[model samples]
Target: MAISCSFFLFMVFTMMDHHVGGHENVCEELRCGGKGPAIRFPFRLSHTRQPDHCSFPGFTLSCTDSNQTLLELPISVKLFVEEIDYISQVIQLSDPNHCFPIELRRLNLSSSPFQFLFHEQDYYPRGYGLFNCSQSTDQRNGIFRISCLSGPTHQVYALDLNDGQSLMELPISSCTKMYNIPYVPEMGDANILHLNWSTPDCRHCEQRGENCRILKNNNSTDESKTECFPRQRNHAKGRTSTKLEIVGAILGSFLLVLLVFAIYRVYRYDKVEKENQAKIEMFLEDYRNLKPSRYTYSDIRRITNEFADKLGQGAYGTVFKGKLSNEIYVAVKILNTSKGKGEEFLNEVGTMGTIHHVNVVRLVGFCADGFRRALVYEFLSNNSLDKFISSADVKNQFLGWDKLQDIAIGIAKGIEYLHQGCDQRILHFDIKPHNILLDQNFNPKISDFGLAKLCSKDQSAVSMTTARGTMGYIAPEVFSRNFGNVTYKVDVYSFGMLLLEMVGGRKNTEVTKENISQVYFPEWIYNCLEQKEDFRVFVEDDGDAHIAKKLAVVGLWCIQWHPLKRPSMKVAVQMLEGGDNLIMPPNPFATTATTRTNARIPAMDFRQELQVIPESE
Candidate 1:
């Protein structure tokens, strides 16, 4: 009976070894068109060519009917596989049809396991950023134009990714920027894109010029381990490799019995936290070399004195008056965001770090200790421009017409700097009276960049999915693309609304039911200008009236319903300086022209001649 049992066990063991070996043969390397790279373990063919457990997560590839391998990435990006170096765990991709450039606007590799691979000839380590500009935009040195994305309407360009700079520093003005892009990929080969995987890394095997194979599978954890293996032509006949696999299986089973399911849960939780942390740390790393000082949460408490003097509150965060020292005071805004990777927080830090203008608020420092984020700003004693411009009752506090004109120029210059002074363009989507702070001398400083966006100067128009800025101050194009594809004109429109509020000394949205007919300044102001009537606000002399009218005309030009009719900030600043041949802009309120008692304005929607006459002419 013992002899019979031993013989039976020997037969069972032989059958089990053959069964496992046959399964490994089934998952053997596959190729496309008989010339493509070998796709084996850690990368399996899609559509049931192999089991899901055979490949690492996010490593599935498909074979096209044309006998080519296709890789679909996050954000609907697709690339044709050119080659795969299994040893190095690197993949080479190409775009023969040139469709990759358009897909780049939607490409984000964060969800994928692969990252861009750098070449020896590549100038920028991370990747090149994309910018779509109009054909009229002047060309720049060291920048390459991507013709595949270019059309009669606009052209696309790529900028090098420097250590601490962005495409917004592109030094070409009058390029007529449109939409913004956020792409990071290797350059030097216009037709090729290279990416590398970290998981299942075969560095040891690669250094030794040998193949690596997944030998052990932790069934409960769904994990696998890769090890270097000697080159073998006949894998099934390799008894040494088979013996190693048997030993690995025995060890894997022993480890599986000792590990609990809860360990996996902890691993998954830790993985998610690490991913989130990696994203925040990556953003901070980009801005690390910038001038703004990084602070700890403990330092924030010491500076604010435990949130002692609250200055104000808004959608983004709350501001507190704090002292950097006895002589220097600062306004610290504790961001009201639990998401450290929030768009608002990143925007404030990213855009403000590079900006330095007299009329723009300074970023003193920032706090990013354990997700507790805060932005320290230069304190202005006079509060915001809204405090003085909101009501007309404060006679002593009101800035005179001359002072207001100077402030307007200062504001215009600031906007001009944001538009043209920087190498790239930065749009303040939430430009309003409240965002303009007042220094002790009442000089205006642009603040609140929670809604800011940075882009190349030469790109084309943008179509925003959501509206930005205060309701009354938001550009018409922001709400609807019918106002023309939204772009920098949105800022021009917000600037117009701000200028009108400055002249009227009231909010555009402060109308109540009791004063509905008597109030509503925008329409009322338009009527006064058309009917040759004096404004209700007090004016000292003819110069005040002239200054008010000039501001109104520039404001009117900026608030045009059609974006093409609005002046660029550069042109608006010149208009404010009284040199440009200014004209009363065709009324944007033409939809209400038929109901008015006396009105004369053209109803022409000049889409064909889509160009702003103010800045360009």
Candidate 2:
């Protein structure tokens, strides 16, 4: 028995010794490639290594085909890492595209783990502007122009965006699209930019031959702080001191207890993760016949570079720019965990996988690893339609009226296809300008199936427990059952609102500086059509006038006060494509505020009463 006890003690001591040696070895050895500064600690190679091997999350590096190390930034930027100074915690970066001026105007480090080397450069308090010009200007205007990128027909200029003199010389009207960014010049190579990062100041302490340790918060008074001290300063003087031996044993025992606790916690975490994974698997079993690929959580993080470049954010999740391959880029939307029963995630994957229309965004893949969920979509260069029309200076960015008419026809066809073409009916509960994504050719595609519902094509009406849609575009029947049972006409109503916004060049319900009766844009258009006005906003000729009038007439017909009065999406498409004269319907809104309130209250009350009734047993 005595021999066995001593053997057990020896085994424990050996394990502790091996653990300490392993930690020291990890710090001493540097990870290196064929050339360049050896990377250690913070910066690690992602996918090729385990997360536990890295000191931090965002400090990951990837190797290029040419053996050069690359670091992707938060703004879809690719930077070649020229040098990494561990002592100073600075990384020297250069643009691989060799367009430093363009990069300087677009670089944003606010949400990143690093910042510009502020002390080395002449910092400008004002923001810089990147002007995309159609023709070169002979005037110097005190702005630094990128001559390498300039050509006879196209020129790019960089100047202080906020400078009154610069603005006067180069007005925004002259440029195609101007980009404003924080101005910070580089130190040595004008082409190279330097960024410094904040990390544990261990290099200085190690250089001074002192030991650094992370102090734990015992009473929760002080947060975790790194302290540097002499390794031998706290040593006991006497070799024969029994107190020292007792203290050593107690400390070693405490460490063993902590190690055991860590192992147990890891086991519990793995169990929970497995359970969640099972749930996701079971939920997606119904979609096995679908075409879209399923991705794991690690796959999602790798695809998005840890959510580095955010494209946009909506109520459900934030979208990030991702690349599946060198030639295939995708938009990965990481769904919020707060969503109920994963229905939204299921809806997006199910509805989009079956859809293959020119005007519908395609789903490339999806991630359903445990609680981490993400939907991958084909990347569209032109982004959403709202960006074009909502811009205050729309002349430069917005496509002309002829193109707008094409986009309207394309959208109407997409809606028509959704109602009639699909084997099972898909109700796009949300159909607004924001959801209408545009492609490179100014073609509009309807996106966002988070609120979409699937029903049989034979069913005329869809049952809903709650109102689903954006406030401005929701149909009246969706808000209240008294107007009518919810049908595909709801989408038609939303499409009509979208059409009016496209025609009027503003929102349908937005109060503008026009006459009080014309504050609502659709009402103003109705008054114009009623009076036989020329429909003069951006109408250069007779053809433009006819297209504008057609769009307005169709919009009014689809937004009638009652669901039965509104034309179906199929009929609406016909009016847009054919040369049939559209007769405007009755006004959807009341003339007085009191009358409007009275019209809305009774229907809203009926919906409330219907919502209270329980399902039949």
Candidate 3:
């Protein structure tokens, strides 16, 4: 019994030393000068000086030879690091020459991890215009002059966005609009920029006067999560002799108790882990019954050439470009270990193994050797639909309006097949442009079945323990039953949003990085439908306009918030494959604000007035 206690004591001390060494080596705080702010975790000295684990991915700083600290943001100019308040997650930055108006004109922080410190209610910072006016111009309320940018007769000012003034409303008499500072909060000192991060959220911990650091876990590979504790950071230089002695005394006592508890916990944990491993093995054995050809882990390595050529990655796994034959290419998705124990692996394999549609991605093979799992799919050279869509961004318009119409039709047919052609009903809970892969010829193919749920054809609804889907595309019904039960219509709703994105140059709800005011894409299209306008997209001829109008109308019909007001995939396919005389869907957004359900629109819910789309909703 005495020997056991001593052995545990030895083990405990060794672990403590190891823990101290791990943090002490890489995350030591740095100083550019005696008065400079302490730089530590989430703000590394440099990649060459510190490991990535010691700091956040993009937050790297450099110390100048003259003892000045420089912090680079997305903008062209590098600002001097004035101070970093880890408590508030805010960083104070200043232009070297104190000419921020010139720097602010060129600054756009949307691409960077930082954002201007704005109130919670304010979704984002307001836009401001920069102008240089004559000294004789209308008297200004506040003077934020940019001396470097102004001449003897002119003074530069960044309009105070909080004052609710526009460029036209500005007293720009004898003033020239130099540039526009699209987004910034009103600061007391215009020369200083205060930017903050929402992540590495240490404010709560800091408010409690506890130190925040990466949450240490032996089991987890993810380092993104952080937690709070009493100061465990190892800055040997910062430690006082008395403080070190006190910490050592406390640890000497605390570690004895912790080690005893840890020994008992480990025994119990090992038993549970063994049981889990056995259960997983049983599940793998059952996977042998699946229809797709089973390949060993070795076969996967050979086929993928050890994952040499990379393709892309998504939520479930990383895809690598592979070659099965000299003539045939494949995309192999190696399932992420963090993805819950074999559930997503089983979901994709079981559903896709039985499917065969031109518009659906083909499952060439799969690998489930021991704990390793991978899925092989037919290679599509054109990549996912997301890259090809978004019109204004595409200079040449890779897929013309005619081709987009065809791709939309093909996607509709694929979804229609999933709903009706399959032996059992398969509801693909996720259907976004990213999941829609394009062939060499630009034919649409639906992929990624990890979120799909199976039900009997006769069943009216399937039970869901949790909502499963990409945000922005998830159906209203999935979030609230008040919208109705989860059904095939969920896919219809997502497809509607996808159609709208393709028609518009951007996402239906996407905001410009510069925060330019643009109407919502769906709302814009809805207004166009009501006004009998051509949607103002780049159009070559009347035929293109007709096709675009047809797609937009069908999309609006399919996205009626309530499942009861959404058309089935079968009806949607008809709408796409049909002629141009399709009547507009009833305004679905009218009653959204008042009541989601229980509000009737007098005989015009989901295509009752129109001959097509089948009043199924």
lDDT of 3 by residue, 526-600 (tens): 878878877767677988788888889888888887777787887888888885577666676676554445345
User: Relative to the true structure, how large is the alpha-carbon lDDT of every model?
Assistant: 0.74, 0.72, 0.76
Clashes of each: 9, 0, 0
- The number of residue pairs in model 2 that clash at the backbone is 0
Which is the better candidate, 2 or 3, if ranked by lDDT? 3
Residues 273-327, candidate 2, lDDT per residue (tens digit)?
8998987787567434447888998988888888899998877889999987445
* lDDT leader: 3
Per-residue lDDT of candidate 1, residues 486-509 (tens digit): 677788888998888888887766
Worst 10 residues of 1 by lDDT: 608-617
lDDT of 3: 0.76
Model 2 misplacement above 4 A: 1-290, 391-393, 508-519, 534-536, 590-617
Better candidate number, 1 or 3, judged by TM-score: 3
Off by over 4 Å in 3: 1-290, 508-520, 592-617
Per-model TM-score on C-alpha atoms? 0.49, 0.49, 0.49
lDDT of 2 at 216: 35
Output the lDDT of residue 212, model 1: 62
State the displacement of the C-alpha of residue 14, model 3, in Å, after optimal TM-score superposition.
76
